[model samples]
Target chain A: MFLIIVEKSNEVIYIKITKIAKAGTLESNDILIMVMPNDSGNIELELESIVMQQFGDVIEQVILHKVKEMGIEGITIKAQDKGALDYTIGARVETAIKRAI
Target chain B: MQKLRRTMLFMPGNNPGMLQDAAILGADAIILDLEDAVSLTEKDSARILVRDAIKYIDYSQVEVVVRVNPLDTEFGPQDVDVIARVKPDTLLVPKADVEEIKLVDIMLAKIEEEEGYLVGSIKIIALIETALGLETVYEVIKASQRMVGVLLGGEDLTADLGITRTKEGEEIFYARNKVATVCRALRVDAIDTPFTDTNDYEGLTKDTARAKSLGLTGKSAINPRQIEIIHAVFAPTEVELKQALRVLAAMEEAEKEGKGVFSLDGKMIDAPVINRARTTVELGQRLGLIER
Candidate 1:
């Protein structure tokens, strides 16, 4: 099972699912947390941190692409996702990305 | 599997001028890069531009290849949809894995099967730039019979390996050689990495030559100037042509004499030698060294 919490100011989002899981954690000053887990079997992934905060889009794109590129089949990402602190989101995403891969 | 454009010049998918100029650049092929070159904000725009370019532009001699973001990215599946709809000469996917390869193949297959395009009509060129990709090269290569070649993408490879860049090529030689060896064994073309230094013509020449010597069928080009250099290095020299012809003539004589093997220019010629000669001829023609 995987548990995810997305908190944005007064808004909080949480998700929990069960399956084979690959997880990552990204947190920074801008975006608090984003976790991604893949439900696909026959694949193992580890999350790597992304240090740069300014380029969240680039980080996200890289991570997403790396996941698809690595073939993680099915994945569920839980984001304690925040905004503005892209560096944090990037780090969280990279870990999720690495895990998904 | 034919000699791909010596220069597969990359045009940023978001840049209209570059894409327009790319058609006129005389590059054998143009790869409208939707991956590294385009920023995340512009991926959608880039896709539109690429689709427009494919639909409107008359490429003539220039082959069109599109480098979609890796399958792991949000854009990969959509990118394939767009490219497959456009049906460019080839679809370039970066950081491909066996599953991704199968995914792209399945998509392309579904598209073609429904639309009646030949199964292998649209070529697939996988860029090997990750550790997992390197480890799975053999499986990945076999994932698609439509796979025409394997591309060595250096920048990403460096990132994947956590290594810094060096101009000497020493750092990448092993990977480069591995790509070539695998391609050769599978009888597929292996494309060498692009030379990032666009202004260094001499450097480009040397790099192209090195790639040729290392058994790469061709190298990628970030600019038009590098294409001719790659083509020149890939073209067979006059001496090679002479030797290839001698082998062919000797083989013909052997066939006439009902002998399976013979000596050509005091060198032993056998089935492998004859096959090699024929392959050279085919490759020479593809390279435009000989007029078909």
Candidate 2:
């Protein structure tokens, strides 16, 4: 039964999960990212940051860039930022997505 | 190419504050740690952070060493990939043995070729943390032409020996001595492990003194507070510096007289003595203890 399911190419294409996968810490200069599967093929990002007023768009772009780099789509990311750098944000999202998959 | 490695301070790779200020901490080398310092889930982030840190930070004269994950782990290859591109001064390989050191050397060569980096420019610091690593220390040190130093990992080595860790460092005495001996024999730097008790200034001083007594070139520092003590312990004292200068003067006079051996303060100054005096003078100059 498992082999038949794996053999069907279309059956494995949409294997997405609704479970929330989290990565990173709430420590200063760190960000926590939670990722979950979404069916609409749209990336919904909810960012809460201390520097949201100034760096919001840049942070969003970084997260999106990382997600695209991983070729991920149809996922919702909840990024709780505590003034994290671009590298930290990307790492958290990458780890969250890996855990989700 | 022996460099000043008196104090190699380790900072967690993910901590931006630490990374930003690493250069100003006055350590001889700044080690951005991507292994034990980072949690499992944060490994990717730490690597990325370290990669960017290496690119942007002005380490000035302080050498930058990145402690990458063990080659057997999932993050190791990724860590090396970034490290190769970033090109830190050295890579510290934890739990390193002969084969692992050789493997990383090969991997680094390949990465250097691919990235157009100078082959063997990035050096290797084999962190001997396992019993097997300890047993194969000679082979591990000899495995790579890029090998610049060997660091003893006390905590893991103690665990491997099933012995208790202590502040006095009695448990790691044998391992430290062995590493120092091997390093001296192979003409590479021997770096002692960090003193875990960050707040015990007296103990830290004593531990560093013990390392110096064992003829270790340097010791790792977990905190900035320890850097001064390590440096002080390793620096040539004024009396020693004076003696070294006198020896040099005596040797120069002997050379003028076409003599191979001479005496200073009623003691024979032969090759070994002259060599020691030269090392003392060089170290004093390097540490800014002696006017160049």
Candidate 3:
């Protein structure tokens, strides 16, 4: 969000997600994120946003970056964005991850 | 010198649109509310959201305030803990009292030391809303070294008093006087509560003017439209500014002539008048109503 991006390292830390966690809302300028455990050893993200055409890639990157920052892997993230900035995106992801763990 | 805080606008903490636009609004300070403005279920998410907004957003040239829940509530501790890490300009403690303020101050001190932030870098503003807090308001303001302001929560204070809050505001008159006088004595900002009716600009101006006359430094605005009206009421009038300038000029002349008292337009001017004029000039300069 601050233009400081870390390399997505190969070392992936996996934690057992015992329950589904969700954060944020569909309000304008907000992004709702839901996290669940996935059996596949890969990170999957399902994204839908009002501004998908303009900022979908950046929003996905922010979510992945935050997930990567938390060293989370083998998890599925679903984000519903309504033009949320990178900070909001990052925060929503962090909150969802915190709840999931 | 005291800062100009004539209009402290209240913005919902969880709304990213409002948070992003807060700085561009003309209020002297913007209060990001995590208390009554937020729902119980959304507390966790709102705290994280507000922290990130403060961390990433550029709120330049305007003071940033965050109103956390009361410590007795479950969310209050986490709110303070998470929000303090971002180091907002000030924390408005609602349902405030001496004991609560002391606890908040202690918590802030520990965080400041642990995080290597300057001890007392984060200021505190007490929201005195209950009868007991009003009775012991002086002690509350003195409880913390970080105390910089006190806001009168009229809605809650009137509810505690078992009285209806009318547009006339006669019910909170005593509370207003007490809070303002104590804040003045302690050299802190005395902020009046928001005038909830957003449609009536005339009523808003009158309410702000009354609060200003009662010695309040500022008034809280529920709507952005109330900001300029509150600021206008607080700014010194053209006649008042002209008279202040004349009194100041005469005071300077008196000082050169080795006298403590002077006269302007056949009227006696003394220490109190001189001090008042100086305060007006300083306030005028702060409001950008006159050239420094």
Candidate 4:
């Protein structure tokens, strides 16, 4: 039960080094996402996952859905998965998109 | 409906595995930390992840508490703005500054208005860690209508006092007792600080026992391993439960016999004893240790 006493973090200095951005982690039940600019004009997704056999398509769907929800295109995405849940996948993808844009 | 909060487990805000596994760990509450646990660079990611976790994950088995960073820091506003909309059971405000807490209450009201969450539905817990905070413990407890509890931060309090914290907790006795007593006096929950040495179960037991002896109702836990021990310390023991059952039964019989007090185990069962026995019996029933 907390109220927002707003203090803006001055530490967030956004210096975009390049078009590539990353978020999430390689830990168990997590996914590492990398977003980079691509001239292909379509989302190119590369994925590796521990539970690929059981839920690869589902995990990939979650990633694509989040990427679409953020209204992003013309990027190549690489997600290294360690069996992350749908929420984790969505969060990581959203974070990477924010960082990239 | 006595909420037994013997253990409140703190999971890092950024970790997916821990958050996924947290509810099944048997803690009465899980605190997802966006404070000291997350590094500066990862704050945004952690906050976003935590928001998604609360939104999608079902943490209804236990109370969900989000420990936002100190409101004086920049990350705190977003922590409260985003997480409060998701409706966590409580938000633990670090530092416990009375004025800041008041400001936070104002902001939470605005968020609740925008999100259509009922005003004062979410709760606040004050983290008593500094001498100045301890001084304003009463004010902090009264800062908001949503205030539910206050937690002692032993490491921070010890550091503030310029004293070394011992496994025996010699340095934080006054702060612990003061917060515990004041919280009780204000009719709010008094939660003890986490035992930092996760490896030392025996020390944790002793430390928890000492806190319980001083009237702390529950303890903040650092590890899942500490939950059982803390619950053991706070839960009504079998002997106490049995005695409480007997006391209540006797009181029931005495009531039928038109007696105001009765003898149980050669001791007079009076109002206070009956109240204690009722609490114990209710707790045992809640834990399924006794038939309702």
Q: Write the per-residue lDDT of candidate 4 for residues B237-276, one digit (tens) a residue.
A: 9999999998888999999999997898788889999988
lDDT of 3 at B8: 90
Between candidates 1 and 3, the DockQ winner = 3
lDDT tens digits, residues B1-292, model 1? 5546566888888655566577888777889999999888657656756776677667767888999988788998888887788788899988888998999998998887777788778889999999889878888999998888889988889889999867767788988889999999998888989999989989888988988888888889887777787888877887787788889877888899999878876888888888878877777877678766
True contacts kept of each: 0.00, 0.37, 0.81, 0.93
TM-score of each: 0.71, 0.87, 0.95, 0.91
- Residue runs of model 3 more than 4 Å from their true location after superposition: A1-12
Q: Lowest lDDT 10-mer window, candidate 3 chain B?
A: B1-10
Error of 2 at B124 (Å): 0.9
Predicted structure 4, TM vs. truth: 0.91
Better of 1 and 4 by lDDT: 4
Chain A only: give the TM-score of model 1: 0.32
User: Where does model 3 sit among the CAPRI classes?
Assistant: medium
- Scored by Cα lDDT, where does model 4 land? 0.87
Cα deviation of B51, candidate 3, in Å = 0.4
TM-score of chain B of 2: 0.97
* Model 4 spans with C-alpha error above 4 angstroms: A1-18, B250-269
Expressed as tens digits, the lDDT of each residue in A17-45 for candidate 1 is: 23332222122322222333444422222
List ranges where model 2 is wrong by over 4 Å.
Answer: A1-19, A68-72
